[model samples]
Target: MAAGTRSRTGASAAEVATRIREAIFAGELVPNQRLVEADLAEAYGASRGHVRTALGELTVEGLVERIQNRGARVRSVPLEEALEIVEVRAAVEALCAARAAERVTDEQAERLRGIGRRMEDAVREGDQAAYAQGNKDLHGAVIGLADQRTAAATIDRLRAQAVRFQYRLSARPGRSQTSLPEHLAIIEAVCARDPEAAARAMREHLASVARAIAESARD
Candidate 1:
């Protein structure tokens, strides 16, 4: 792992779980690194049982894997997994975009603008991590504006994995700069109440991510 492991601020097992999940998504927990329960427990000030429990949850998400007697480690996401997630992301985003077009209100629009502004600030500060976090808040706002509870919930679930380990590759080059514009496009399309345009823009944006992932794997 090029980046040193993190000791995040969350205290409880559940909070640690979130921290770990975020680390995975941010590529802080690099692929194939052995996850020592003792190390994690100490780092998070959690019990071994708590760390184990957290690992089990991530395993179900396919973000980690357990070896019979060896212990747990961050899973190396296969090429197929990335492609599948990308496809699902496209479909879900398209639906959300369409629904948002129909349901997004003026207040939601203002809220989104605020989120975008914060995201832009993060970018200007050159804080990729903060920028990424802000981007997530913005996306959640967009989908939440659609008011489709089921769709919103499903996208949230999928995002755990979709976002997992993405930042490792995302840190490569130009991702942060490009992402803001892409997000702005999605917001614009939905604001215009053009479902097809929104869907197409979202699809293209996600597809670009897939291309980046593929290129990263080759490198």
Candidate 2:
């Protein structure tokens, strides 16, 4: 087998799945774009079998869809469904924030504060890209602090499905400015070790996001 067509032994199915998942999240693999097994196998340095396995796994995660006769493609979540997904994320991530507040170590608290600072800098400099990245980093940090594998896994899958909508929301005029304080509230609550406050802040932030999504759908 050529280097590009490595044997299944080269990369595991789970590894291939992660590569494809990250590609989707990064917008490298766009919504409704066909995922040809042969192309994926070569691009990801995996066997066709592994690519197939990966596609099946991603389908289960709601990131990929198989057409009746056509091959798998990136799933395009509709705006309405996207709003529902955010609603669900709000609940689950609120739980994570509450747990993180209860369980955060001093070092973790410092990290959360650092992320908040970066977000503030990004907004001050009118750096939307940096602010968007900080948004992801802050949420990821809080989830890590929570140490709840189940909730983290759930959030990851939900995020994968709604990443396109997230990109849209981030690019909207004044979006980063509006969301900055909401994210800071989450960070401050978590850093303060106040579980109720953390959960409330998280819920409010996502509620704001959900409302934004709904508003955009009408425009």
Consecutive 10-residue window with the lowest summed lDDT within model 1: 1-10
Error of 1 at 11 (Å): 7.2
Tell me how candidate 1 scores on lDDT. 0.75
**Residue lDDT tens for model 2, 1-219:** 322343635676777898999999898999999999999888877788888988998998999999989999999999889999999999999999999999998998898889999999999999998998899999999999899999999999998899888888888889988999999999999989999999999999999999988777687
Clashes (N, CA, C under 3 Å) per candidate: 1, 0
lDDT of 1 by residue, 16-84 (tens): 677788887666777788999899988888666667778887788677899899999888767778778
The collision pairs in model 2 are none
- For all candidates in order, the CA lDDT equals 0.75, 0.90
